[model samples]
Target: MSEQALTLKQSGIRWLWLAVVIFVADIAIKFVVMENMGYGWSNRIEVLPFFNLLYVHNYGAAFSFLSDQSGWQRWFFTAIAFAVTGMLSYWMSKLPAKEKWNNIAYAMIIGGAVGNVFDRVVHGFVVDYLDFYWGTYHWPAFNLADTTICIGAAMIIIDSFRSEKKSD
Candidate 1:
Protein backbone atom coordinates (compact mmCIF):
# COMPACT_ATOMS: atom_id res chain seq x y z
CA MET A 1 0.00 0.00 0.00
CA SER A 2 1.02 3.64 -0.40
CA GLU A 3 2.88 5.37 2.43
CA GLN A 4 0.18 8.04 2.73
CA ALA A 5 -2.52 5.44 3.10
CA LEU A 6 -0.52 3.62 5.75
CA THR A 7 -0.01 6.84 7.63
CA LEU A 8 -3.73 7.49 7.50
CA LYS A 9 -4.49 4.10 9.03
CA GLN A 10 -2.10 4.80 11.86
CA SER A 11 -3.43 8.30 12.48
CA GLY A 12 -7.07 7.31 12.56
CA ILE A 13 -7.52 7.67 16.31
CA ARG A 14 -8.68 11.27 16.05
CA TRP A 15 -11.16 10.36 13.35
CA LEU A 16 -12.57 7.51 15.38
CA TRP A 17 -12.68 9.66 18.50
CA LEU A 18 -14.51 12.43 16.70
CA ALA A 19 -17.10 9.95 15.48
CA VAL A 20 -17.54 8.58 19.00
CA VAL A 21 -17.97 12.06 20.43
CA ILE A 22 -20.55 13.13 17.90
CA PHE A 23 -22.41 9.86 18.24
CA VAL A 24 -22.53 10.04 22.03
CA ALA A 25 -23.59 13.65 22.04
CA ASP A 26 -26.29 13.04 19.49
CA ILE A 27 -27.63 10.13 21.52
CA ALA A 28 -27.68 12.12 24.75
CA ILE A 29 -29.51 15.03 23.20
CA LYS A 30 -32.02 12.79 21.50
CA PHE A 31 -32.69 10.97 24.72
CA VAL A 32 -33.35 14.19 26.57
CA VAL A 33 -35.60 15.49 23.84
CA MET A 34 -37.55 12.28 23.68
CA GLU A 35 -37.94 11.86 27.39
CA ASN A 36 -38.81 15.48 28.16
CA MET A 37 -40.56 16.71 25.08
CA GLY A 38 -43.04 13.84 24.81
CA TYR A 39 -44.29 12.70 21.44
CA GLY A 40 -45.70 15.47 19.25
CA TRP A 41 -45.05 18.13 21.86
CA SER A 42 -44.16 21.48 20.30
CA ASN A 43 -43.73 25.06 21.33
CA ARG A 44 -43.61 28.01 18.97
CA ILE A 45 -41.10 30.77 19.49
CA GLU A 46 -40.36 33.33 16.81
CA VAL A 47 -36.68 34.07 16.78
CA LEU A 48 -36.30 35.55 13.30
CA PRO A 49 -38.33 36.91 10.43
CA PHE A 50 -39.18 33.38 9.47
CA PHE A 51 -38.40 30.85 12.14
CA ASN A 52 -40.28 28.92 14.80
CA LEU A 53 -39.63 26.06 17.24
CA LEU A 54 -42.15 23.35 16.52
CA TYR A 55 -41.44 19.99 18.06
CA VAL A 56 -42.22 17.15 15.70
CA HIS A 57 -41.74 13.43 15.26
CA ASN A 58 -40.77 11.99 11.94
CA TYR A 59 -41.64 8.43 10.93
CA GLY A 60 -39.79 8.46 7.66
CA ALA A 61 -37.26 10.27 5.57
CA ALA A 62 -36.89 13.94 4.73
CA PHE A 63 -39.99 16.15 4.60
CA SER A 64 -42.06 13.27 5.93
CA PHE A 65 -41.39 11.62 2.60
CA LEU A 66 -42.67 8.07 2.60
CA SER A 67 -43.91 8.51 6.14
CA ASP A 68 -47.17 6.83 5.34
CA GLN A 69 -45.66 3.65 4.03
CA SER A 70 -46.77 0.27 5.26
CA GLY A 71 -44.84 -1.76 7.83
CA TRP A 72 -42.47 -3.15 5.22
CA GLN A 73 -40.69 0.18 4.89
CA ARG A 74 -39.28 -0.15 8.40
CA TRP A 75 -37.15 -3.14 7.51
CA PHE A 76 -36.27 -1.61 4.15
CA PHE A 77 -35.07 1.57 5.80
CA THR A 78 -33.21 -0.42 8.42
CA ALA A 79 -31.34 -2.26 5.70
CA ILE A 80 -30.57 1.00 3.98
CA ALA A 81 -29.33 2.50 7.22
CA PHE A 82 -27.02 -0.44 7.81
CA ALA A 83 -25.60 -0.20 4.32
CA VAL A 84 -25.01 3.52 4.58
CA THR A 85 -23.34 3.24 7.97
CA GLY A 86 -20.95 0.58 6.71
CA MET A 87 -20.03 2.57 3.63
CA LEU A 88 -19.43 5.76 5.57
CA SER A 89 -17.40 3.96 8.21
CA TYR A 90 -15.16 2.47 5.58
CA TRP A 91 -14.75 5.84 3.88
CA MET A 92 -13.86 7.51 7.15
CA SER A 93 -11.24 4.87 7.93
CA LYS A 94 -9.59 5.31 4.54
CA LEU A 95 -9.32 9.10 4.62
CA PRO A 96 -5.82 10.34 3.89
CA ALA A 97 -3.60 11.22 6.82
CA LYS A 98 -3.05 14.80 8.04
CA GLU A 99 -6.33 15.81 6.52
CA LYS A 100 -7.68 16.85 9.88
CA TRP A 101 -10.55 18.89 8.56
CA ASN A 102 -11.42 16.28 5.99
CA ASN A 103 -11.31 13.57 8.59
CA ILE A 104 -13.47 15.64 10.88
CA ALA A 105 -15.98 16.13 8.12
CA TYR A 106 -16.09 12.45 7.42
CA ALA A 107 -16.35 11.64 11.10
CA MET A 108 -19.27 14.00 11.48
CA ILE A 109 -21.12 12.48 8.58
CA ILE A 110 -20.53 8.92 9.70
CA GLY A 111 -21.46 9.69 13.27
CA GLY A 112 -24.69 11.39 12.31
CA ALA A 113 -25.66 8.65 9.92
CA VAL A 114 -25.03 6.00 12.54
CA GLY A 115 -26.89 7.97 15.15
CA ASN A 116 -30.03 8.03 13.03
CA VAL A 117 -29.52 4.41 12.18
CA PHE A 118 -29.58 3.54 15.84
CA ASP A 119 -32.91 5.23 16.09
CA ARG A 120 -34.20 3.34 13.11
CA VAL A 121 -33.14 0.03 14.56
CA VAL A 122 -34.57 0.63 18.01
CA HIS A 123 -37.61 2.78 17.25
CA GLY A 124 -38.29 1.95 13.63
CA PHE A 125 -38.00 5.67 12.77
CA VAL A 126 -36.01 8.79 13.38
CA VAL A 127 -37.20 11.40 15.82
CA ASP A 128 -37.05 14.88 14.35
CA TYR A 129 -37.55 18.21 16.07
CA LEU A 130 -36.67 21.87 15.52
CA ASP A 131 -39.18 23.39 13.15
CA PHE A 132 -38.78 26.48 11.02
CA TYR A 133 -41.55 28.32 9.23
CA TRP A 134 -42.28 31.46 7.25
CA GLY A 135 -45.93 32.47 7.27
CA THR A 136 -47.49 29.60 5.38
CA TYR A 137 -44.22 28.06 4.28
CA HIS A 138 -42.43 25.52 6.45
CA TRP A 139 -39.25 23.58 6.31
CA PRO A 140 -39.09 20.01 7.42
CA ALA A 141 -38.36 19.40 11.08
CA PHE A 142 -34.89 18.09 11.83
CA ASN A 143 -32.56 17.24 14.69
CA LEU A 144 -28.90 17.52 15.63
CA ALA A 145 -27.97 14.47 13.59
CA ASP A 146 -29.54 15.98 10.52
CA THR A 147 -27.73 19.26 11.10
CA THR A 148 -24.38 17.50 11.42
CA ILE A 149 -24.96 15.50 8.26
CA CYS A 150 -25.85 18.61 6.30
CA ILE A 151 -22.90 20.59 7.61
CA GLY A 152 -20.48 17.73 7.06
CA ALA A 153 -21.71 17.23 3.51
CA ALA A 154 -21.21 20.94 2.90
CA MET A 155 -17.70 20.80 4.27
CA ILE A 156 -16.89 17.79 2.11
CA ILE A 157 -18.05 19.69 -0.95
CA ILE A 158 -16.05 22.75 0.03
CA ASP A 159 -12.96 20.65 0.61
CA SER A 160 -13.38 18.94 -2.73
CA PHE A 161 -13.42 22.36 -4.37
CA ARG A 162 -10.37 23.43 -2.41
CA SER A 163 -8.48 20.31 -3.40
CA GLU A 164 -9.32 20.80 -7.07
CA LYS A 165 -8.08 24.37 -6.86
CA LYS A 166 -4.81 23.26 -5.29
CA SER A 167 -4.38 20.54 -7.88
CA ASP A 168 -4.88 23.08 -10.64
Candidate 2:
Protein backbone atom coordinates (compact mmCIF):
# COMPACT_ATOMS: atom_id res chain seq x y z
CA MET A 1 0.00 0.00 0.00
CA SER A 2 1.04 3.62 -0.53
CA GLU A 3 2.55 5.47 2.42
CA GLN A 4 -0.37 7.92 2.44
CA ALA A 5 -2.87 5.08 2.48
CA LEU A 6 -1.04 3.34 5.33
CA THR A 7 -0.92 6.54 7.36
CA LEU A 8 -4.60 7.16 6.90
CA LYS A 9 -5.48 3.62 7.92
CA GLN A 10 -3.34 3.92 11.05
CA SER A 11 -4.92 7.23 11.96
CA GLY A 12 -8.38 5.80 11.61
CA ILE A 13 -7.52 2.94 13.90
CA ARG A 14 -6.03 5.33 16.46
CA TRP A 15 -9.20 7.41 16.57
CA LEU A 16 -11.25 4.30 17.25
CA TRP A 17 -9.39 3.83 20.55
CA LEU A 18 -11.30 6.76 22.02
CA ALA A 19 -14.55 4.94 21.30
CA VAL A 20 -13.29 1.81 22.96
CA VAL A 21 -12.27 3.78 26.05
CA ILE A 22 -15.65 5.46 26.29
CA PHE A 23 -17.49 2.18 25.86
CA VAL A 24 -15.45 0.49 28.55
CA ALA A 25 -15.81 3.37 30.98
CA ASP A 26 -19.54 3.57 30.37
CA ILE A 27 -19.98 -0.15 31.01
CA ALA A 28 -17.74 -0.18 34.07
CA ILE A 29 -19.51 2.75 35.68
CA LYS A 30 -22.90 1.25 34.97
CA PHE A 31 -21.82 -2.03 36.48
CA VAL A 32 -20.64 -0.28 39.62
CA VAL A 33 -23.93 1.59 39.92
CA MET A 34 -25.86 -1.61 39.42
CA GLU A 35 -23.89 -3.38 42.13
CA ASN A 36 -23.88 -0.58 44.69
CA MET A 37 -27.07 1.37 44.18
CA GLY A 38 -30.57 0.08 44.70
CA TYR A 39 -33.05 0.21 41.89
CA GLY A 40 -35.61 3.00 41.35
CA TRP A 41 -35.86 6.59 42.52
CA SER A 42 -36.43 5.69 46.14
CA ASN A 43 -32.81 4.69 46.46
CA ARG A 44 -31.15 7.89 45.29
CA ILE A 45 -27.98 8.90 47.12
CA GLU A 46 -27.55 12.63 47.20
CA VAL A 47 -24.00 13.66 46.38
CA LEU A 48 -24.74 17.35 46.14
CA PRO A 49 -27.59 19.78 46.24
CA PHE A 50 -27.95 19.49 42.46
CA PHE A 51 -26.59 16.05 41.87
CA ASN A 52 -27.35 12.54 43.03
CA LEU A 53 -26.57 8.96 42.22
CA LEU A 54 -29.86 7.46 41.12
CA TYR A 55 -30.90 4.36 39.21
CA VAL A 56 -33.30 4.32 36.35
CA HIS A 57 -34.03 1.94 33.51
CA ASN A 58 -35.07 3.58 30.30
CA TYR A 59 -36.77 1.24 27.86
CA GLY A 60 -37.32 3.83 25.20
CA ALA A 61 -35.48 6.71 23.57
CA ALA A 62 -34.22 9.89 25.20
CA PHE A 63 -36.22 11.23 28.12
CA SER A 64 -38.11 7.94 28.35
CA PHE A 65 -40.08 8.48 25.19
CA LEU A 66 -42.23 5.45 24.40
CA SER A 67 -41.13 3.86 27.68
CA ASP A 68 -44.79 3.28 28.36
CA GLN A 69 -45.21 1.26 25.20
CA SER A 70 -45.61 -2.49 25.21
CA GLY A 71 -42.01 -3.64 24.59
CA TRP A 72 -41.11 -3.28 20.91
CA GLN A 73 -39.17 -0.12 21.66
CA ARG A 74 -36.34 -2.12 23.16
CA TRP A 75 -35.49 -3.88 19.93
CA PHE A 76 -36.22 -0.77 17.94
CA PHE A 77 -33.80 1.38 19.87
CA THR A 78 -31.20 -1.35 19.87
CA ALA A 79 -31.36 -1.64 16.12
CA ILE A 80 -31.12 2.12 15.77
CA ALA A 81 -28.04 2.23 17.97
CA PHE A 82 -26.34 -0.44 15.90
CA ALA A 83 -27.19 1.36 12.71
CA VAL A 84 -25.84 4.62 14.06
CA THR A 85 -22.63 2.98 15.22
CA GLY A 86 -22.04 1.42 11.81
CA MET A 87 -22.60 4.73 10.07
CA LEU A 88 -20.28 6.57 12.44
CA SER A 89 -17.57 4.02 11.89
CA TYR A 90 -17.82 4.48 8.16
CA TRP A 91 -17.86 8.24 8.50
CA MET A 92 -14.83 8.24 10.73
CA SER A 93 -12.93 6.07 8.30
CA LYS A 94 -13.56 8.60 5.55
CA LEU A 95 -12.44 11.64 7.55
CA PRO A 96 -8.93 12.99 7.03
CA ALA A 97 -6.44 12.27 9.79
CA LYS A 98 -5.97 15.95 10.50
CA GLU A 99 -9.63 16.43 11.31
CA LYS A 100 -9.16 15.69 14.97
CA TRP A 101 -12.35 17.34 16.20
CA ASN A 102 -14.56 15.47 13.77
CA ASN A 103 -12.87 12.19 14.56
CA ILE A 104 -13.21 12.74 18.30
CA ALA A 105 -16.88 13.52 17.88
CA TYR A 106 -17.46 10.37 15.87
CA ALA A 107 -15.52 8.27 18.34
CA MET A 108 -17.54 9.55 21.27
CA ILE A 109 -20.80 8.88 19.44
CA ILE A 110 -19.81 5.39 18.38
CA GLY A 111 -18.69 4.47 21.88
CA GLY A 112 -21.79 5.85 23.52
CA ALA A 113 -24.07 4.11 21.04
CA VAL A 114 -22.36 0.79 21.61
CA GLY A 115 -22.59 1.20 25.36
CA ASN A 116 -26.32 1.87 25.27
CA VAL A 117 -26.91 -0.90 22.76
CA PHE A 118 -25.18 -3.39 25.03
CA ASP A 119 -27.40 -2.40 27.91
CA ARG A 120 -30.58 -2.69 25.87
CA VAL A 121 -29.58 -6.10 24.57
CA VAL A 122 -28.58 -7.51 27.94
CA HIS A 123 -30.85 -5.72 30.40
CA GLY A 124 -33.82 -4.81 28.19
CA PHE A 125 -33.25 -1.19 29.12
CA VAL A 126 -30.57 1.50 29.35
CA VAL A 127 -29.22 1.73 32.88
CA ASP A 128 -29.05 5.37 33.89
CA TYR A 129 -27.81 7.27 36.93
CA LEU A 130 -26.11 10.67 37.51
CA ASP A 131 -29.17 12.59 38.49
CA PHE A 132 -29.25 16.41 38.56
CA TYR A 133 -31.98 18.51 40.08
CA TRP A 134 -32.92 22.08 40.96
CA GLY A 135 -35.42 23.04 43.57
CA THR A 136 -38.47 20.88 42.87
CA TYR A 137 -37.49 20.01 39.30
CA HIS A 138 -35.27 17.16 38.23
CA TRP A 139 -33.59 16.41 34.96
CA PRO A 140 -34.07 12.99 33.48
CA ALA A 141 -31.48 10.59 34.81
CA PHE A 142 -28.66 9.78 32.38
CA ASN A 143 -25.44 7.76 32.35
CA LEU A 144 -21.95 8.35 30.98
CA ALA A 145 -22.93 7.03 27.59
CA ASP A 146 -25.69 9.59 27.29
CA THR A 147 -23.33 12.34 28.38
CA THR A 148 -20.69 11.29 25.86
CA ILE A 149 -23.22 11.23 23.05
CA CYS A 150 -24.43 14.73 23.91
CA ILE A 151 -20.88 16.05 24.12
CA GLY A 152 -20.03 14.47 20.81
CA ALA A 153 -23.06 16.05 19.20
CA ALA A 154 -22.14 19.43 20.60
CA MET A 155 -18.59 19.06 19.34
CA ILE A 156 -19.87 18.28 15.88
CA ILE A 157 -22.01 21.38 15.91
CA ILE A 158 -19.12 23.52 17.01
CA ASP A 159 -16.80 22.03 14.43
CA SER A 160 -19.32 22.69 11.70
CA PHE A 161 -19.43 26.36 12.54
CA ARG A 162 -15.68 26.54 12.78
CA SER A 163 -15.30 24.91 9.41
CA GLU A 164 -17.83 27.30 7.93
CA LYS A 165 -16.02 30.30 9.34
CA LYS A 166 -12.74 29.10 7.92
CA SER A 167 -14.30 28.82 4.46
CA ASP A 168 -15.93 32.24 4.61
lDDT of each prediction vs. the true structure?
A: 0.74, 0.89
TM-score each candidate. Answer: 0.81, 0.93
Best by lDDT: 2
Q: What digit string (tens of lDDT, one per residue) describes model 2 on residues 1-168?
A: 998678667665459889999999999999999999899999999999999998889988788999999999999988888898888887877777677888899899889999999998999999999889999899898999999999999999998899899999
Worst 10 residues of 1 by lDDT: 37-46
In TM-score terms, which candidate is top? 2
**Deviation in Å, model 1, residue 51 alpha carbon:** 4.0
Whole-model lDDT, model 2: 0.89
Q: So what's the TM-score on candidate 1?
A: 0.81
Write out the backbone clash pairs for model 1. Answer: none
After superposing candidate 1, which stretches have Cα over 4 Å from the reference? 1-9, 41-50
